[model samples]
Target: MTHYRIDALRQTLVLAAPSDGLPHCTFWGARLPDGADLAQVAASAALDLTGGMLDANPELTLCPQTAAAFPGQPGLVVRSPDGTPLRPVFTKAGTKRTDTLSLAYTDEDLGLTLTFRFAADAATGIITASTTLDSDTPVLCDWLAAPVLPGPQLADQMIDFAGRWCDEFQPVTTPWATGIRARDNRTGRTGHEHFPAIILPARGCTNTGGEAHALHYGWSGGHRMLAEELPDGRRQIQFGHATASDPLPGTRFETAPLYAAFSDTGLNGCAVSFQRHLRDRIVTWPQPDTPRPVHYNCWEAIYFDHSLAALTAIADRAAALGAERFVLDDGWFKGRNDDTTSLGDWTIDATKWPDGLTPLIDHIHGLGMTFGLWFEPEMVNADSDLARAHPDWILGPTTQPLGRGQYVLDMANADLRDHLFTQITTTLSTHDIEYIKWDHNRVLPYNDAAQTRGTYDLLKRLRDAHPEVEIESCSSGGGRIDFGIMAHTQRVWLSDSNDALSRLRIQHDAALFLPSCVTGSHVGPRTCHTTGRIHSISFRAWVAAQRHMGFEMDPRELTDAEAATLTKVTAWYKANRDWLRTADILRLDAADPAIIAEQQQAADGTRFVVFAGHAGTSTQIAPRPLRLTGLDPAASYTIDLANREDISSLSRGTPALKSGPLTLTGQSLMSQGIALPYDLPDSMWIIEGHRA
Candidate 1:
């Protein structure tokens, strides 16, 4: 047998392949202790047992089987020449690299060959596994998986997400029972309900406690994250592009890669690993040297009002308020007065602009703010010119349910996909647009896998053609957020609801895996359009400024005081954004669930930016004191207020920040939590700390 070991971000993943009989590979998860003997540990580890180096009993990373062999949950199930289930038999295995292994199998009965490809990053502890099945004989494949690992039955706890549109990333925990726990998003897109992730906590787990092994699917289309615990105490976890492909004779079918990461420092540790992988390896956009702009999007402000004069007036106010990106959302296209028409038309509304987008684009550029536009490339209304021209472009049946008064464009069709590529690339070539708010409003009605590949291909082509254009993935808000989409886009619109209180929870949950720099956190209007809840400008700006700062309101409508507050917040984010973009996020576990504190620490351990916020939830006479996390133990630090607010003004009786620049050791601040003001429940605090 041969062993492959890869160490990544404090954790280690080991893959084993048998020398002679059945060249199946098994995955083992473990913590990388300092100066441990890798060979000694791999020698004692068993493929099916849990403990030692093999903390996890993951079946072949890509389990290809048939009904005759290892029966249930086979990685690949294809019909034999006799129209029966065919299983793959191991042929040989080879060591590709120290961090990679390749295993090949063949099904003589079906004349098919299946090969598994596995690779791991030694820095992020993220293992990516993919497979390809080739044949000269045509066969009907029931289902195919990228990679499915059998989890240890000892992992008694499981965590996943469930939510709707505005309420996204709501974590749900359940004890591992006998039956199967399946999360299927058949919406043909990464549905708003559940993100493609699963975490198995060791025995009993807390936010920062216990060991966590997490798996995230890299495909964005309809996906399945499943965990099935059998009667023999074996648990199988599978995730991939939730569909099968029928390979033609002499053709090859491949599966997308699935990512797996493990951490002993609990869920947050696993999150940190994933976040590092995304920012450092996966995300394609180049991080600008300056801070991400405080964008002013005119979706809520203008909606369908797209006259050049009206947009110019709004752009002036946005620039005055220090908005760096002015996005003219929807209704800028030909004959697009509402969502009912003009989806696939890329041309500007000549009536609205009189000439073209150049007038408004030039005006926005003159104001020292970049210009952005909205595009729903994969959607077409029945009333659109593109749909009218190409009637067969829509995916699904002859008649399908419509969303936002439109049907999904079938990118699976080569002709339709090429047309979309032409329209989008043409628009980019013609305009000096800096950003695109790419929106996907509806779900895929049927055969979503092809559509997903088409979407990815289209984006890849767009990126290659226009490398400077940045794209924001907005799937009706929080619908298409995963490592798969992150590989193609810049930022995600966190949620449609900009109500600060709602965002406090949503942003907290999203930041678990998504870094603050890639999350679109916007300060909406005082009266939130979705929730109808009003919030103070101080509270709203405080929440949004901490992330990829932006505004979703009309700056011209804001009061003078509110406008000034917006400007100040934008300036503050710009000054501290360098550290914010690169810091390791540490989410503190508070006794009160309502009190959320996130600390961003610089790599050198010299600086820290702590953002703390609380919803209007009070217990007894006061709210609980907040404790910070991830600080140097013995280092002395100076805590200074961002806005120069005195400690007394913040909290009535707390003495921690009464004097000028409260100085304390990092150990003291973490061990003994700081008391916060009970009166200002809606407000948030931005405390800066520097090693002194």
Candidate 2:
């Protein structure tokens, strides 16, 4: 048995290990901040807010229970709700968790205690972590842990604050049979319901409700999350939590998100994900000179059964639109349709491109638009030439464990890496390849024998060999987006999902972690990648304005009038490019009851606002002169013509001129309040005002 004591008056909480001594897994000293009430800290900065990294050896930051301020001392006094400040200090050595950390908060009044726990799971060689909230008061158990991955995997723990948390080492009876019936050992209550522990190896596992709550389910990575309450009423989990594989051990290992998640609460979870990634990986962006994409991309028309004539059509269109770069997506290589076959053959397919890629690239460059090509270099099909040619190079044992599935190329083997490098690098150097979109489709699968150390060098070698080439990352659409990848690539594909409403959150979360200039959000048409249902065009326009805007649709499908509008918007974006590229964005709620998005000045005294109406609802936005955060209110400025829907509509419709107050009270929905009779979801008014 172990006993714990707290010196509440002095402001220190201490824990004791079991007297008989528990083997392995050492725990560190625990302390609750002074002036911090355990109850409040648990909600906002509980265990979920704390983090552990392979880099930071000692120092730790934790969310104490909510009480405002917490005093600091090596050993003082603190109390728990049950008067048992059982802050257990452990020292488990020679075990899997070589490094460890823990944080917990308690409050007698609210009967709440918040706690966070994390440590390296050396056995799995990936970090195994989790978070939980405890209450002496009545509530179900709330907890979450990193989901497992297919092969050897890393662990991540995501958490949301704003409540109390407590560590629960206390054992409890798990559910019996299939029902939520468990024995509450503490309360002696039978048939107690508790949230089932999440089980995820491929994706991050999540759970919540300080009490039992919702069943965990969602697409694994690269999306935003709505705040969800578990079946238990005691806890809630939102986005802003992440985990990563043990960075390929090297000087340049990164621990940031390959896929980021943003929260509905407006928290920039992507930023948090990457900031943590920086803990392990080297950040190699803004490569040397001022790095920027030479132009936009048009890959759809140029991908499938397109001839030189068809490709040139896209090239000509991109040039007319002032796009300086054109990228050729899939179908250039020999035999690639679905994920079924035709990889590893980097050679140009004679059937599609009898003249090779150089001619099209040469044609593009001749038109002043640089050429870029796509390649999934890391993955190969079993029937591909590379695999057929060198069966031994595939990752497996000599005994031939080919029994279950197809073979995998062992990047760990120097010979394999060098061979693949020769093929890929030769293609890049032979042609004037300026940009490369490196994609990886599947996760790694190394049997016990086929693996080796130093996998991180794969990217470094590829990039060092061709430093001048700008790379864009896409893993079947962003499963590979991360700072480690960003070090070499110029930008990343945000998502394959081009729908606007979906983009609002996707782009919002993506930009939070990545800079707007480095992003390539496209102004895709309503009939986007999948659904093909046309959404509010304004929504596309708004999402496009937030980052380095482009489009993914066939320009031929749009009506002449819509094309003209796109041209107009493109022109305006180019003119005010600095506003978004170098501005601070602050979202405000408009009087229209819609999501009011606004951007402050970039390099000047200009401020812009976008007021998007609710889906299918026509609403009037009451003009509120926002106290611009980063603008000079004393200076006078003129609002641009395209920014005002009133002016743009009048200029488009009546061929008349009209000027009124900053507030568009008397104007019609199309004029001032930006309508959504359909889903004018991206309808807005960009207001550039006089500083005074």
Candidate 3:
């Protein structure tokens, strides 16, 4: 039999591999500076080693759980409990190189992780790293109860937010997820489901006034992970590669790559998700001051007849219905609306805004509405005025192999950051811009400047400059929609996919861990950029309620009836938003064909149950009339009769469910708790039950 040993002395952690075949590894200078309790420091290191592995894997090979929990002389070891050697012997393993580095250790049996902080009384704060985990057997990940689970308050916030997500209408009701996975012996990776895990992003970081470090968790690279803290107290995770063979790219793309921060995660980088998890816990959710308009938009209006009159006409229609805000989207920006030309120029196109955007603004405002504008300030056209004027200003690589994009700014440079910041700030501050829909068209085309990583610094600087702007982040749509992005930005366009049914899936999955205000649902047109599926009028507003709702279609063409429905729904959201905003969400079940996650928030004596779902009620037997989990049933209450269609259905089928009394119970009828037979597809019922 082979054995493993680990020891923690002050800031040093030494793992001694069995002489039989496993090699031992020693890591020193592992303690936090400023002299922590030496014993506590040692215990912390041991725990980090034990738990880090366990956090990543639940099924263990050995009974190292107890040993890791109480590390001293022999330390702790993990192996297959069924006496199967999980990994092969690696008596002499080769060393590897990586871009970034961090370390994490886990207990195999108990499934625990012990993430190390600073080394105890260590010499260098810069942190040097080394490790030796043998190539033995595969360990199945299972980190159910790690010390770092976001606290109860954060968890509750997530549940509440998730409930709203569920409440949004989804045709399939079942939580739908699609992802691409690599095939062992295939040409391309295939998309698969039944996910082992998922990543949910609420809003692209809403620029809250705070430190950059606070939002950061870890970085990835070289298989090593490093975590860091910015001056403002926000956390960031860094990633490093796991091996030393080849230098890894620091570029951010969606693949299994290493990231690093400064934490004790030794994958050459930090894990991609730890800081994101932390960010999800701390950001504050701000409700909309005014009920936003169920707007129509046009990025496609380019070359598709987006004249000022057409746009005003759209605004006119939206206004007639009492919508609060009307946004004149893209094509209006200086010479834009195509894959080329006029990007750096932020002026309005006279060709498009003939009466000067002021008339449109005045008219929209005259109609008792605020006006919004869109800007893709991150990129530049190779032939734009800004590029031609200040050629050196654009970010470019000195050497060859520069990726795509004709013009990119040097965001890392202070002058450039200030330049771009001033431009955007000036525009946003100067105009009747009640709302600024900020979009980042691309991640980064090129950052090969000898100076610094410009794009990220530029964003951080912009966040600092425009703290109060109601900014929306759009990297295409789903890109960069992380807590880091949300910390500075208020809302994120949920997806380019605005089809209400599709939104049900995107939003239901998104809301589980995001703030309610972070979700962005646009009352998209009959067909647009994503999915191209048109939605019913009712389903549009039903799902849009998940987050800040807007319009993504041409406002002018909506039928008077469509406009009226929009007006009514907007009013409804405005009237009772308080209930939805502050309620606590309880995810009732995850396996239903239509997953049910409900929210209950109390303001006065009224308790609101927001039943968020994926599929309509037809999946189950009228859900047992939804025997609400926490309610004083005997108390008198008034179920909001807002759902007339539901009223009609109950009257016809479930005749037992009468409004006058709480004692209305009927026998199982032909109609289960499904949406009314002849009602709209995605509708929300604000059932207000009170302690009568």
Candidate 4:
């Protein structure tokens, strides 16, 4: 028997290989003592024999094999070229260890080799694992999971996400069951309906306390997740590409990296791990030193109706309101007056701007705001010039039904990618554009792993050519938001629904895997375009301020008072954005269920800001005290209600915080919590704190 251990600051994973078979994780949890005995630990984890069971239980290896008689779902499923199911029993062949670990296993008779790789980052407390399969001859890969890991036995329920167009990042919790709980996303995109992540919280776990484990499958195309508890009571988690995503026979197949984390400090620990890893490690910023700019998008403002005069005036107003970037949304391309036409035609619309986009770009630059343009390069309208000219470039059958009046382009085709690269580069070279809002308004008719790889290739090529330009991944809202796509883009449009009430919940839940810097939340019109619900400017502004601040509403529609409120919040965001950009967003546990709140703490723990949104009316009279987390308990701090003036008239008695700032020890503040000023539904209270 051989034992190996990988350690992060907060957790450790120990793998054991017995009888020269593929290694299986024997222990995964809090870090063990440096002098601990690995061999004894592996022996301690063994299950005793029972009646009706095999004399010796088969090891649940990294890639559990059918030939090994493992009871749970096999991690790798493949077949020969003629469709004969192949069961390859992998045996230890080689091992490599450094900062990262790699183990190789071979099945000589099957002419196949399997390898598992793991890299543990102590700073981020995340362990990234992946699996690869190599065959001497071509084989069809039905499913290939990343390195399988043991699920936490103490966890009673697991949380996954399910959402739709205007609503994203909604958590769905399920109790642990005897059989498998599987989630498969076959939409060809990292869909809003199926976010590729799972969280296992122990029985008493909360947002800020107790043990938890999480795994995010960092693949944007599509994925399958399985959390299975065998009859023998052992649990295993498996994540991989959507079953049969690779339809063609190939000699090599690999699964995308699966980011796994263990948190003894609760769900927030896992959240912070993913957040920091994505922002600090995975995403490559174009301008690393620059502060995130306040964005103003003109999709809900002007839609497809483009006029130079209207847009220029809007740009002037946006600049006045403190917008540092102006993004001209859809309808900019040739003959594109609506979503029904002109997709895939990247040329500027001569009729919409006879002078081209130069005038708008120049005017925006003149106002001290950078310019960004929108593009849907992956989709084509049937009436588009590209589609009409090269019908073969369409991905699916000609008779396939259209989605949102557009069809997916064959991204797997090098020629199509080359054409798109040239078209996009021509525009980038023609203008002084600094950003691109890359939008995918529709899903592909079928799933194809090659399509995602091809898109990544094109994005990489573009980034290499125009390294200074930044990109945002926007797929009709939150469709393609995963670590995979984020590798090539800087920001993500959290959702299309700009309703402040909805945004409060969405942003809070999304913080599990996304940090504030890369999450783009925008203020919309008084009446939301998607939900048709009206919200006050203060509520909208504060909610948007929770992440990468932006505005998506028309400035012309704002009343003077509304505009004043927006400008004030914009200024506040700008003033604190330097620290806010890198802050760890800690979700507060509000005693009142109606309140959705979060605390953004500075890296040094010297300053913090809390945004408490009154999502709805409280069940009982008066507001309940909300407790904050991730604080220095022994330090003294001063807390002030930044928006005390927004308090409603119904609050007759003066709350201590409503009247003036209070100084207290962090322990007292966290233990007893703070009483916030009374506010109505759809309103938000801003509280600022500083160490005294």
Expressed as tens digits, the lDDT of each residue in 306-351 for candidate 3 is 6766766766766565457666666676676565777778877777
Q: For residue 141, what is the lDDT in candidate 4?
A: 95
**Measured by C-alpha RMSD in angstroms, how accurate is candidate 2?**
14.8
lDDT by candidate, in order shown: 0.76, 0.43, 0.41, 0.92
Query: What is the C-alpha lDDT profile of model 4 across 176-264, one tens digit per residue?
Result: 99999998888999999999999999889888889998999999998999999998999999999999999999999999999988888
Candidate 1, residues 1-692, lDDT tens digits: the string is: 56555566566665555654333334456755757665666555444543442344333434635432443466666665456765556455344554566666665655676777777787666777777777767666656676567675558778888889999999888778877888767788887787888888888655666677888877778776778776546677877666543332225667667777787676778777777788778887654665677788999988998787888998898888778998888898899999998889988888887888999999999999998889999999889888888888878664877898999988878888788788888888998998999999887776457788888988998888888888999999999998888888998998888989889888888877888888898889989999998888878997997688898887777998888888888888888888788777777777776677787778678998877886766565666666776677798988876754413344556545444467788888788866654446667777788998
Root-mean-square deviation of Cα positions for candidate 4 versus the true structure, in angstroms: 0.8
Candidate 3 TM-score, C-alpha based? 0.57
Output the number of the TM-score-best candidate. 4
Look at candidate 2 and tell me the lDDT of residue 210. Answer: 14
TM-score of 1: 0.93
Return the candidate ranking by lDDT, descending. Answer: 4, 1, 2, 3
TM-score of 2: 0.57
Question: TM-score of every model?
Answer: 0.93, 0.57, 0.57, 0.99
Give the clashing residue pairs of candidate 4, or none: none
The C-alpha local distance difference test score for the whole of candidate 3 amounts to 0.41
* Tens digits of lDDT, candidate 2, 357-458: 878888898988777888876556776788888777765543444321234466567887787778878888889887877665544443211121223356
Estimate the Cα RMSD of every predicted model relative to the unseen true structure.
3.6, 14.8, 14.3, 0.8
Candidate 4: regions farther than 4 A off: none
